[model samples]
Every structure is written in C-alpha cells, then in structure tokens.
Target: MTEDSSQAEHVAGTEHASVADRAAGGKAARAQTPLNSHRGWSPAEDRPDPVALLEEQNLTRVPDLVPVRHGRMMASPFTFYRGGAKIMATDLKDTPRAGLIVQLCGDAHLSNFGVFASPERNLLFDLNDFDETLPGPFEYDVLRMTASFTIAARNNGFSSSDIREVTLEAVRSYREAMIQFSGMRTLDIWYARMSEQELLAAMDMARANQKGKAARKASKALEKNALKNAAKARSRDSMQALAKLAEFVDGHYRIISQPPIVIPVRELAETFGLTAEETEAAVRDQLKAYRQTLQDDRRRLLERFDVVDVAHKVVGVGSVGNRAFIVLLQGRDEQDPLFLQVKEATASVLEDHLPKSIFEQPGERVVQGQRMMQAASDIFLGWTRGMQADRYLYWRQLRDMKGSVVVEAMVPMGMTFYAHACGWTLARAHARSGDPIAIAAYLGGSDKFDRAVTDFAHRYADQNDADYQAFLDAVRTGRLVARGGV
Candidate 1:
C-alpha cells in the first residue's frame, strides 16, 4: 500500500471520536514516538549529497536561468536554505513523526509567510507560497519554520542566545496557539485569521510594553516600517504593474522587454521558430483552459478582459528557473489593466519521501492545497495544463497588495516578534485541515516539544552551513556556473 493510504488508515476513525478519546489517542502516540526523541540531527551514512540534489533539480529548469538560481542561492546560507526544500525533505523523512497529518506548506520557511490581499479585499497574513505543498506530519512544517529562524538569525549576526531565544519563540507560539485552537469550535477555527489592522495593533501593544527607552525606540521604528510596508503593499496592484512593466508601442500597450528576466513573448517565439501570432494563440488557449477551472462568477469576470501581451518573467529565489509568465489583459479601455502570472507547478518536494499526492496533475495539487490552507485566497487562482506534455501551470494575479518582511535587516527583538507571529499563523493554518485537539494534546502543555525542536534547528543550521560551503565549492571548481547581479 502507498504511504498515504497507510497513514490515512492509522488516523481513519479518530475524527469522529470523542474529545476525551482523541486526547487519549494523542497521549498514546508518545509511546511510539517520544517528544524528546525529536532532538538533534545527524546525516545518515547514506545521506544524499546536498549539492548533487540541487544540481538534479536544475536539470528540470530552464538552462539559461539555472545559473541565476545558483547565484541567488549562493548569496548566503540563508538563501541556500530557502531553495533547499528538497534537501530538507530528504532529511526530515528520517526523523520521527507524531503520526498526525496536516496539509503542509512543505516549504514553510520564514519568508514564505506574508501578507496578501484576500478575496474580500482585506489584507490577511497567511502562508503566501504553496508551490511545494503536500500532506505530511505536522512537525515537518514546524521544524522547517524554526530552522529558518535559526539560519536567518545567524545570517543577521545574532548571538547564540538570541538565536536560541528567537527559535524558541516560534515553536512556543505554535504550541500555545495550538492548545488554544484545540478548544475552539470548528467554525470559529475556520473563521480565525490575522488581519493587517490586528497585526499592526499587536505590534503597537508589544512596542508599548518594552521596558527601556532604547528598546521601545527600536520597537517603534520596526512598527513604523511595518506600517509603511503595509501601505506600500496596498498600492501594488495591476495599475502599478501596468505603469512599471507595460508601455505604448506601435499604437498599443505591450509588455516592455527586459531580456533574461522579463522577455516579451515575441522574442521567445522567435527562439522556438514560431511566429508571434502562433505564440499568442497558444497562450490564449491556456487561459481558456484555466478559466474553466475557476468558479462561474470568476469565469464571467475573466471573460470581460482581452489579452493584450505576454512575457516570460523570472520570479522568486527558489522558483527562479521554473516556467513563469506574466499575461497582460485590458478591460473596458486602455486604462483598465490586469496582470496574471502563470507559473509552472512541479510535484511537491515532499512527494519524494512521503506519500505521492492524490491529485494527478501537479497544477491542480497546488491550487487545491492553497485553497484548503488559506482562510481566503486570490479570486483569480486556478490551474491549467501547458501546451507541452508534462507541463502543469497555475494562474493568479501578478500582484494584489502583497508584502513580506525583510529578514536581512531584522534585529533580534524584531525577529522574535516576527517569529511569534509566524508560529501562531502556522498553527492556525494546520488547525484548519488537521486535528487540533490530537496534535495539541500530543504537544502537551509544556516547553518540551519547543526545546526539542529548537535543538534540532541548531544542528540543522550547522548542516546547512556545511552544505552551503559545498555549494560554493562546486561553483568555484566549475562544477556549477553562477551568474551574479541578474
């Protein structure tokens, strides 16, 4: 039997069990996998080479842009970790699980959590990236998140104690929040979400509680910066994209050419020996297929716009070499513009070590996972198969008031605060699709799980440093080519 089927059978009847029975089941889980056993990490004797794993992934990416991915990852160990989800997934599979499951973010590093405009036009803080999402042990996501804080904190030159404290805050907040969720009604848990205003107010309260003048001053500065970024995000819409990326040429608006990073479709069509008209027709066909995946209302809304232009756009550090394109559409008139991003969706990295996803198409797996995890998702979210065989793609607005914290500039206190927020948000997301009571009960009412995971984070950070050095060595010896300043 498949791993997913086996695991599903393990928890099959627990959902309908009494609360007391569920709690007992959680307690019983400790016998099979003790919480303290989660501490420490050691590469197995047969562990795969991390650099080789990255090179394997590059084999599937656009050859010209693979170096860009390498260069981006070579920026720092933290950046490498961001793109090393496959490496971590390999390592995590050897670790103990609580036998509990959740729809995982799969790559739940610190940067993946961010604020985006929900369907209701409200700014909501949630998991913003789902390219590698899948169902797996709940701890896998938590470990990935906590380890991210450790790597990021170290990159910022945080002291050992400060790093430990920050990492602990993330896991602790998750534990405490899960306990709270365990008591909430199903509907309340579903409705729970962190809004921008609520986040800002929380920051304000935290700043006010700082004890010293310098501390409070620093806190206030971070708060102000966050507020400024939120306001900036609000202005980052289709109008902004049109102003920055589109221009009038030959009497019509077309996407401006910025080769390697943003190449117009006409340029790409020539590379493949296809005419511009033929290329645009293929793009339109993909859009029509994607529209069918959307709700009736969304499909109607989409039909009002006409495709104007398309371009190849490289996006995100980890997703650099994947097939990604920006589609320009005009509604009513030239002034009404909408930009939709169509990105290639590959199988989740976790699928290598865990159960294969039930969804056959990778694009549908991503779309369904995002819809299940987020409290509210982008209105334009959908999926489609590309013209080429084995190419699956998902579509969403290019921008909708999206913003993320700049981890490089964060201080210890700022990181701790951010960690707490991430931990709480992750717990809420897991609560939605997993059994909060059983998972929370398994965690218990102590810092034991937090401390154990923190220990694992420290060890994993060391391993990441070693792997990063190996990657740099590969680039130096001509085993890998990296183009910087792209």
Candidate 2:
C-alpha cells in the first residue's frame, strides 16, 4: 500500500473500533479518541501550494469556462473558499482527526445546506450538495461547516466575538443533536428531519429571546424574509423555468438564447460543428440511456414529455466550468413542461485521499451518495454515460422549490439561528451514514469538541483569507485569467 493509504488504515484502526466494538457505545468510543484532545490547530510545516492545487482542478474542467470559475472564486474570500475545497482536503490530510468515518459532504460549507421539496412535496432542510461526498473522518465536515460560517461572517462585517459565538453555537447544536440521535431507534434516526414549520418556529424562538427593540425588530424581519424566500422557492417550478428560458419560436417552443450564460440548442450544435440532425440524434440516444437509470414509473413519466430544446447553462460558483446542460420538455402542450438538468459528474475532490468508490461511473457515485444521505430524494434522479463513454452525468429536475438561506442580508440573530439549523441538518445526515451511538459517545456531553472545532474554524478562515489574496495576485499577474461579467 502507498504511504498515505497505510497511514489512513492505521489511523482508522487506532481511532475508531469496528462495528462490534461500537456496540459498547460511547465509553468504548471515547477510549479510542478523547474529546478534549481534539482542541487546537497546527499547520504542517510542509503543505501544497493552494494555487497549484486549484490549477490542477482546472485541468479537468472545460477550458473556455475556466476563466469564469476563476472570476467567481475571485469575487470574495467566502466565494474563493467555496471553490477551494480541494485546498482544504490537502490541508486536512495533516490536521488532527478522530478517524471516525462517515459519508462526508466533502464541501459541507454553510451555503451547501438548504430547503428543497421532498418527493412528498414537503419542503425539508438538509445537506443539499453531494458532488464531493466521500467516506472519511466525520470531523472533516464539521470543520468545513464551521469555517464557512466564520468566513461568511467576516465577509458580512461581523465582529470577532460574534463570529466565535456563531461558530460555537453551530458546533454545539451538532453535538447536542448527535446525542439526541444516539438514543433513538434506527428507524427514528432515519425518519428524523427538519421541516419548514419547524424552521420558522426556530426563528420565532430566537425572536422571543431578543432583549432590545432593534434586536427584536431585526429578528422579526428575518422571519418575514424567510417566509418570503420560501414562497419564492415554491414558485420556482418547471413552469417558471419554461416561462423564463423558452419562447414560442416558429410555432414551436424552443429555449431562448441569452449568451454567454444560456446558449440554445441550434447555437450549441453549430458551435460543436454538428448538424441539427446529428445533435438531435445524439440527444435522443442519451435521453434513452438516461431513462434506463430511473425506476419504471419515473421512466414512464419521462416518456410523456417530449423534449423540445436543450441548452448549455452556467451554474453555481464552484461548478461554473463544469458541463451542465438544461433539457426542456413539453407534456401535451406548451404550457405543460418539465426541465431536467443533465450535469456532468467528475471524480470527487475527496477521492484522492479516501477509498475509491466501487461504482464505475462518477455519476453513480453522486446519485447513490445523495440518495443515501438525503431524507427524501427526487423521483426522477438517475445517471448515464456520455456518447464516447468517457464522461458520467446525472439528471434531475432543474429546480423544484429549491432554495437556500440568504447569508448576505442576515443579522447576527438570523446568522446564529441559521447556523444552528445547518448544524442539526448535518448531524442528521451524518447519523444516517455513520454510527451515531459511537460518534455521540466520542463527542461526550462536553464543550471540548465544540471549542476545538471553533478554534480550527477561526484558524482555517485566516489561512483561507491569505489564500484568496494569493489567488487575486495570480489573476492580476496573468498567472490565472479571471473573466469579468461572467
């Protein structure tokens, strides 16, 4: 075995007991890794260059859109941190860890958690992104999440004391929630979820604890804002997508071109030097293959919709350069439509340091990981390979009541409450994939892990800030090109 592989195995053996050992519960788990020792942060004397690591990731992404990725990462330190998951993965290799393994949301920053409609049409909050999901030390997700809160708070002009409090509260919530999950039955833990009513109730509780008039007013405003955002998300269904992205062209509905973000089917075909006949044929074959990945019922549901147009669209801060295509389909009439996003799935950032997944296709890794971690998933979720069989891709509804908390406009109370929600959501996700009994035991009923995580988050945010400056320097010196207005 390689040196890193051997070390990982050793760490795993020494830090966490096997499933049989885990039956001994918290006491046995604590004997393996103490909670207090998790405190402190120390950077390794030798570390990889952040810029080099980022440039390496760029190699796998689309060449033309790479500049746009750079530009988005350059927007702010927090934004840079979003795309710098690879850098942290490298740094985390040398950090102190308990070695308790779980299916990690490798990039489990604050914004990655959100509210989305479950198959039952109930809006539930959970870890919504799994592109970088992998099995690794559980604390890695906690570190990523806490640091994100700090980085975002700093961006929003939060005081140092406030940042620390928010981070602490987030960590505490996770610890307490894990304890709650530890005592529950397996089915209970699996069924546990945070719903819209529960979320608003949390906000109301926060609002009640306010001391000053201004604080109370801000709390009320945040609650009102959240309600408005939820309503807006509910309206962002396939019909809305059709209205915004499709137009009645030559008596048939076709995607509207809004270059360089959204490019229509004909435009993309010409750009690829393919005739309309070739492009349509290629799409049909890919769609047929994708249908096979879904369940029989969902496949039949997809058959009812006739694909009218396809477009290449830019999406997300970190996923800017990745190949993400939106397929527009009509059911019976132009008014009834469904939008499916067929996104290219690359090797996860965590794959380098973690065990390789058994699945042959990267899309399978993402789709399976998501289904395992989510409380409920999309009925149409599935995967397929590219025409050349060189690429993996997954398909899902474009946006069915998907929304995230707006961090930019948040007050201190709002931020703290949101942080708690994210922590609870993450803990529930971890409990589904990891041994909650042992994890809760390892954490214990103390603030040691909480304080340690807070410390690590602060230090990592400092490192991330410095790295963001270096990235800006690279762009300024033409070492990296960052396209403006992308």
lDDT of each: 0.91, 0.84
Going through the candidates in the order shown, the clash numbers are 0, 0
Regions of model 1 farther than 4 Å from truth? 1-14
Q: lDDT value for candidate 1?
A: 0.91
Instruction: State the lDDT of candidate 2 residue by residue for 79-183, as single tens digits.
Output: 999999999988887765565677788899998988889988999888888888777778889989999999999999999899998899899999999989888
Candidate 2 residues lying further than 4 Å off, grouped into runs, are 1-29, 270-273
Predicted structure 2: clash tally: 0
Candidate 1 lDDT, 357-421, residue by residue in tens: 87899999899888878889999999999877788999999999999989999999899999999
Candidate with the greatest TM-score versus the true structure? 1
